[model samples]
Target chain A: MQRAKVVGTLWLSSAIEDIRGFKILILKDLSSSKGGYFLAVDTVQAGVGDEVFTVSGSAARQSEATKNSVSDTAIVAIIDRVNEENI
Target chain B: MQRAKVVGTLWLSSAIEDIRGFKILILKDLSSSKGGYFLAVDTVQAGVGDEVFTVSGSAARQSEATKNSVSDTAIVAIIDRVNEENI
Candidate 1:
């Protein structure tokens, strides 16, 4: 998992059949500034500016909310705080 | 999914319970020059130097090879070619 910030929501009039019910959000990787942003399915009810931990790849499709979906990324948790010393 | 090159193999004396039978390989993103490398479970029998497409998040765990595993990344397919003009 990686830490990211929710930047915005994506609205698609037509989407792949497996991803019909999920909310897709834009996420910026907090660890890198050069990679730009990527879209992720929101499962934790995160909002813009919220710090979240995301799972990518097939692990994203395993989320209960995205099961059987074609999502390649998903917000798995909303981070409350981080302490670098303990990491 | 993203395109990446298999770099090397990882030998773990002990691993997380959910990922025991999976073979973990190092992957470098083919699309980026600065992101370094990350670990991915191999499902498609990829070898070092092979270009492969990988799935992340829960979708990775849903693969027949990684079902019930805790992998956050997985190699889903081996790429044969790319036609950028048609993309």
Candidate 2:
């Protein structure tokens, strides 16, 4: 799992059958200090400015929205707050 | 696979054995044009600000650097250019 910040949303008018009816979002990768981002399918109702926890691979499939769904990445949790004092 | 732009690099002092000695980067997810990003292991010699093709899951493990290495996401190709006239 990794910590990420939601940057934007993805609207797919026509998508692969397996990915139909899913809300996709663009997330900024925060696991590393370097600023980066990626497209992820959001299971949780994350908004444009929310911080989230992302799970990839088989673990991503275990999410409530991806259960039995063909997805490689999913937002597993919505972070309430971040305490990065150690860093 | 997804089309992404390399945004930055990640340095890990302490990492899981499976991911040791690998160059990790933060990638902006451009496949959906949502301006999102994710932390990914770079298999190709992709520099920051380069557009890349990313492969996730078991497929990522098939890359030259990841062959027999335990990783879930890897930069599979360095995109020469993007023609998004369709978008």
Tens-place lDDT digits, model 1, residues B36-61: 68889887778999876666766666
Candidate 2 local lDDT, A1-87, one digit each (tens): 788888765554223344557666767778986656666678878877788999877676775666644456788789887767856
- Candidate 2 lDDT (Cα, whole model)? 0.70
DockQ of candidate 1 relative to the true structure = 0.09
Candidate 1 lDDT (Cα, whole model)? Answer: 0.72
How do the predictions measure up, each by TM-score?
A: 0.53, 0.52
- List candidate 1 segments past 4 Å from native: A1-70, A73-87, B85-87
Scored against the true structure, residue B66 in model 2 reaches a CA lDDT of 74
All candidates: interface RMSD: 9.8, 9.4
Per residue, candidate 2 scores C-alpha lDDT tens digits across B1-87 of 476788898888777788889999999887653577798887667889987766588646654467667777777556543322111
Model 2 lDDT at residue A85: 82
lDDT of 1 by residue, A1-87 (tens): 788888766554323345456676666678675755566778988988898999876677676787786578789999999877745
